[model samples]
Target: MPHIFTNRLGGVSSGAYESMNLGVNRGDDPACVRENYRRLAALLGMERGRFALASQKHTDIILRADFRHAKNDVFDPADFVADGLVTRERGLALVVFAADCVPVLLDGGEAVAAVHAGWRGTALGIAAKALRELGCAPGSVRAYIGPSIGACCFETGPEVPRAMLGLMGAEAEPFIVRSGEKYRVDLKGLNRRQLELAGVPAGSIEVSPDCTFCLHDKYWSHRYAGDARGSQCGAIVML
Candidate 1:
């Protein structure tokens, strides 16, 4: 996968979404976001006009975006209400943004996809939808699980684990740990399991070692930063 998983280290945003805030609809200065996107495009060796993005809704809805949507002047929420995007068009970059959610990238056989899988989307099988949209057999797809809230700091009530257990069963059990009345959830690990269950090979999955919640300075952690946070992004290219 020709992908770039970026932290909030390099950009020109200020205040809350400081430096590399990739979110355009988050009330930040559009010029700043544009500059950040420009920097990102330069790093990826792609034209900023070719970098397509979606307004991730934490749903299983998968949409295909190209340079057209990438250059749309409007930032309406409906313009890109997709959790996952798949494309076979080379030079068009697919981007997925997240603060605490898992940003998954999968590419194989001239097709690639970027997915935003929060807990709700995970329960709803967004990753599986991405695989299907990419038009690749699950076994042939290589997945990259990007930085997200990790087990180290993802303390949640039993309801979280219950939803996961109900959605994934014992296959996801090992990633959930019991801690008194709370559960320490390994969302990335469980999402990897979700990919596996969807037929993606376990050996083909690569996970980022950094955890958003634990590495808050390096990432934007909604759980740790509340409403005032930036975003990290997962960008993939199809070759």
Candidate 2:
């Protein structure tokens, strides 16, 4: 399995997008976005045409993809809406976009999945859903929880903690902190806990220490740049 969580480096887009903007709908030039994908494909040693991207809506929807879904052009409108993509097809890359949202990559030996987990998706346990979609024993799956807004800066309203608590109960407490009238949530930790609860061994899961909000200059961060910024991606392929 080959996987990569890209940053805001090594691409052609400029302005607020700067370079390495993989998002096609972020108002970046289509030509530049395509060239970015070319650079990414070259780095991965995979064809650009074999990439299948997710139309993320912050939902828990996971779609099983194949060669038929591959598209070389990022401008192509995604026919399906899903926050996660799973595939067993060799050479076909599964891609999920994120800025402040957590991007999770799963490798189950024969199958791989790329998931976009925002606070809503995390509360829905989208990672666990993707794991179940892999149809593999959780202990055998390897997971990577990529960069996102960390607890140090992810202050939110009560609804965020409420949703997490409703889904994970007491297990969600330690990852949350009460900050006056607001709350600070650790999305990466919550996603990791979801994977562990779904049966993935704790040692098999790797969490990135990088926080997108803190490292906004290095990675795209919605909290830092808002709609003026571009998006990065987490891609995986079974080869």
Candidate 3:
């Protein structure tokens, strides 16, 4: 799989989204965001302006990448809230922004995906959907689970873990840690399980040891700085 993760460490965005913010339509200056994309492109060793982006909406919507839709230029900044992005073409970079949510990158022989999975998306099995759209059986797919809110920091009420349990039943146990009145949710673990459910081998999955909530200097944590903070991103490309 295409290895990728971008924090607040690189870029030109100022104020909340700070520098290197790849979120195009988040009200940051268009030129600054473009420059940030340029930096990310350099980091990924590709053309500075040729990255395929997605419009995320916290749902399980995933689009297939082929000849026509697989343009190598990133210019569509109208509505970026699609939750997941998948592609089977080389040189077309794919990305998804996540502050408190998770960035799951899946890849194999021909297809790749970068997905934004919040509690809602995880409950809806967005990763599984992306795997299906990638047209690769789960066994061959390699998944890189990028940094986000970890279990120690992601304390949620019953609703979040409930949805996970509702969908995954007993499979959600190992990922959810109960803590008296609250629950410590392991999004990475849950997503790993989802990828496993979709057929990705457990050994092929790699979860980031970084936790955004504890490492503000290394990442953008919405829970750390509230709405004034910038965002982080996960990007992948076919090679």
Per-residue accuracy of model 2 over 214-233 as CA lDDT, tens digit each: 99999999999989999999
Predicted structure with the largest lDDT when compared to the true one? 2
Which 10 consecutive residues of model 1 have the lowest summed lDDT? 71-80
lDDT of prediction 3: 0.82
lDDT of each: 0.84, 0.92, 0.82
lDDT of 3 by residue, 1-239 (tens): 44579888768888877787877656788788777878887777776435666677888888765445543345564343467888777877787888879999988778888899999999999988888888877789899999989998999999998999999999999988889999999998999999888788889999998888988888888888877766678988765
Sort by TM-score, best first. 2, 1, 3
> Could you tell me every candidate's TM-score relative to the true structure?
0.93, 0.98, 0.92
